[model samples]
Target: MACISSDSSDLYDVLAGRPRLTGLALAPSDDRLIASVQVINGEGNAFVPGLWEVDPAGEWEARRVTRSLQGEYAPAFAPDGRLMFLSSRENTDPFTRTSSDSTGPGLWSLPEYGEAERIVHHPSGISAFTVAHGAGTVAYTASVLPGAADTAAHAEFREKRESAKITAVLYDSGPTRFGGADLGPAEPHTFVLRPDGTQADVGGQGVVGGGDLALSPDGTLVAYTRAVAGSDPDVNANVVVVADAATGEVRRIFSRPGHHYHRLVFTADGRSLVSQRQRELTYDTPWRVTLVAFDPASGAETDLLPDFDNWPWPGSPVVSPVPGDATVWFTGDERGHCPVFRRGPDGTVTRLTSSGAYSSLCVALDGTTLFALRSTIDSPPDVVRLDAAAPDQQPVTLWAPADPGPLPGTLTEVHTTADDGFPLRAWPVLPRDASAERPAPLVVLPHGGPQMSWSGWTFGFGPWPFAARGYAVLLPDPALSTGYGQRMQERGLGQYGGRPYRDIMMLADATQTRDDIDATRTGLAGHSYGGYIANRAATLTDRFKAIVTYGGQWNLESFQAETDLHAHARRIFGDPLTQRQRYETDSPHLDVRKAMTPMLVVHGGKDYRVPVGQALGLFNDLQRHEVPVKFLYFPDESHSVGAPNHVRILYETVLNFLDHHVLGQEWHRPQLL
Candidate 1:
């Protein structure tokens, strides 16, 4: 795999080899450089971590940062340019009675230019930490027990009984000691750092915690989101609160009864605060990004950008420190694709990059440079830098000295009408070499999250593999997809295998007419909710030539009964017994005898969510009925196949099966019991 720059204009491949860069962090300085690296082997078989420094000229230098630690991650540069990181020391004593002898998470610091040393060690767990902008003080949240024995006991209890209560403590940078002021028994919230080396909790009392806390440039006021308890499926979180750092007095500046306050930032002059709010929902709730301005003196709120769709799922909003300007930078979704956007004082939105497949973005201290992580289906993630001041400037790749494989085909937006005339959105990825004369086979790839929408991104299974192998892929985001609005997501409730199934079939029908798609050799694949769709599609229609399910549920009844998150399922679906008709109608087991498509069922043996028994039940039914079916079980894998070797084998096996059934091409067959 190779690294591809984010700027479409300067699209050039960098790095050429098997080792793929997996993680990246950019320095705060506007030097267009990255501070860390996570690499994966060429076959995507192994993951290795190291620290690196990449200069503006695209030069790379890497060194092993933590040799004594087993697993290290979440590295950040301190105010004084020192590297602060989290690492878990290897605990070989299987029978150790003390937490110190058992594995524990610790925080360590190293000169941004030197060797690493222990900073703070928590016998229980260190959840998070933040360094003051220029104060060189570190404020962190940690869960600690009374003693080593108690820590060990809590760990064992969490493993065996699945229940353990740990105390969360907030501490300022000081000499090593396990004691501090108790933040609370509840989850640790975001800590706002003050310039004077003091930190305050932004989250108040409640289960509906806080996220994305932003402090003003002068560090006078802090803005954060607060969710109200018992508000499910409602997009609007309760309120956006602003607190005075000096007095610790807080005021609720903005409130949306059912929508969530997603992101917050103060204006350039600190005269007003801007925040993004969206309606909250349990399943698929469509979200809209609205910007609100708050007055500091009177606690008055006003809408700055009422129609600002650019902040869809907006997060990490940062107001520039430069004077005489009121611009804010944030990342949000546009038409199902997430992109980084910079909003000018006049409310003009400038898209920073063409590629919408990005998880995070951060602006440098100068506020003129932007560092982002971008990825797509065929490409692994890499950090890239963009000059925010010059929108037309080219992007520079900062990690992974290789070219990403060819773009995983081309995705085109599609819409199909369900039985009720409701339009569903979908994306069809056509084969790279597809043409009217030599049409490719079709793969109907239903998305998981029957509640979550399939946002356009580079790759994560689905039709990407099939399309890469000369097949066309159709991905349908049925009524249950979020971001379309609350009404659309609520359509999935008590209607699984109903409207959602019809939506997928309609998408398949629309794809069959594509000049580069062959309807006769179509297939279906999905995981989780998608797995359920795959099984249901095979049983409901003979249009598919083959089907694959990854850790998918076969029987909704068994799923509700066996899943570890039974409480969540119960809340989402109500009482299963009362919704017996919906469960029966949705279960693939009910119509397994009707399944004619050659099916491959894959499951991780340790998956407790969609238990392996779900796959086993479907496989057993197919076997009893003499259906052409295969089952592959990974003993050490879980709901997700995390091991590199297992992942490679799984993909190979799936491709081989698809080749044989969908393309009528002979391929090596893996042994399936």
Candidate 2:
């Protein structure tokens, strides 16, 4: 292993030089595992996440699977042990494959011991795909231009329009954009790739967007989630349906109001389907969610863990779909630890792993071994293997080819009792040399997604470089954080200003009492929803010497009007016309006159989630009020940034802000600005 420099510059160098592991895949035989590593291509300045074979036997051996300069990802093992994935590589000969010459993702395949070959090219890019466990059938989702019968026809139409220099998107009254969409000019559809390399239409024109699709064990049927056509996708609910793979016959199996379904996975028996269902019973109910199993033939749905007190995470199913194995596995965010659990078919839920966050769960065909990507608050995710039958025993770390170098500091969690009597779990990172005799400055950093928690082991987000710069960082989970029960979320919904704000302040106040933390030199910072709280904190109190907000919103009224998923505004704050008071009360824009501490506002120009206008408008208001503030803008970035140099600049800019204000160091501006 190469030794890493202990200096804080190492943190900056890695953030700017490293590729991130996006996903993981396990062979059916459980002999090997592969992962998708996304790194920035320097020549193009674009993220190119490619597949790599990962060894979990501790040899730390790794081999690159695909060498396409254009990149490949989403690896899956075929029934015959071949690898299949999606690629957007440009074709060498434009005349032979004119359709693939365009900028669209195409399906590619590689035998166990041969070079990869292009299977079929979709005029539009393929988003997600699944391979049948038993029959080896393949199903995938793609975008199709409206009124086009096939990919070639759409390609011709697209070329004609582009040649004529047309750039208008005519629309009706439906939503112009959805929360989870590929942001293409065409509607999404699902198709079955035939064994002979042909294409079979599954959704055709009936489907408007490509939703979650799962193939049955025998490859006879597919269950997928899609919204009803001719409805507003932003506000409409998505339902699940089963379709005959060969006949294209579809059956609507599940639908409910105020509930949206995805992750449509079929059990090994093929008689039932399982989904991570989100049940938002009311507009402000937070979310009462659980895993549900539905008998497609009987049209009966059963809640897997109806009495389970915690949220089971609504994205991907943690349980491995093993034939005759009725146990469901998942991890829930409790107090501070996000623990893994195994639920018996009889509804008995048991804890599997004791602490830390887990992801990319994969189990063997017979359910004997479990592999996942695990991480903690002070570290990023890495490959790990655990006992499938009984995971209470500590898991083993897999061999990693590349090193993440060394951490800049140490992380520790502290508890503080909120005014409501419920204890708050907050993580504080201290510098390596800090002690009672030489206290370090403190920075309160809240995470984004008030609905999200701060339990995982991610090294990049915060504190790493900050602590290395002789500053202490604190991350706290308030009432609205998920994985805790629905009751805790309800207490935070419209009650943001009072509880969430006070809860964060309480944690910072407690840290001040510690002899290792300096009480006078304190800073506050947050991104997204956390940034919203940071904005409110600046106006509500001057306890911190400096504050920073990235991709945050200050005015709920205007934020709701411009946000992509505008309906959430009504769900969280009710109608701006009716519950007018709630929307205005906590908004930092309305209370900017009270702000005194110095602030730094940063935003991505392409952000549609919170909208870039929120930052520009707030920056204007702060400037109008003569508040000490600076706005850092990224023109080519989105809500989240992946470009290596952009990420490095973000960290550098943030650290410089705190260095001058909190540490009283000379302000060093990032050269990229």
Off by more than 4 A, model 2: 1-7, 56-60, 92-96, 178-184, 204-211, 229-236, 312-315, 318-321
Q: Give the Cα lDDT of each candidate.
A: 0.62, 0.76
Tens-digit lDDT track of model 1 for 49-108? 555555654565443555542546666666556677766655333453344433555667
lDDT of 1 at 516: 83
Span of 10 residues, lowest total lDDT, candidate 2: 173-182
Best by lDDT: 2
For residues 181-257, what per-residue lDDT tens digits would candidate 2 score against the true structure?
Answer: 32445777778875666667777523344648888878888777776655543345667878888767887558766
lDDT of 2 at 541: 92
Best by TM-score: 2
Global Cα lDDT for candidate 2: 0.76
* Model 1 worst lDDT run, 10 consecutive residues: 173-182
Candidate 2 local Cα displacement, residue 166, angstroms? 2.2
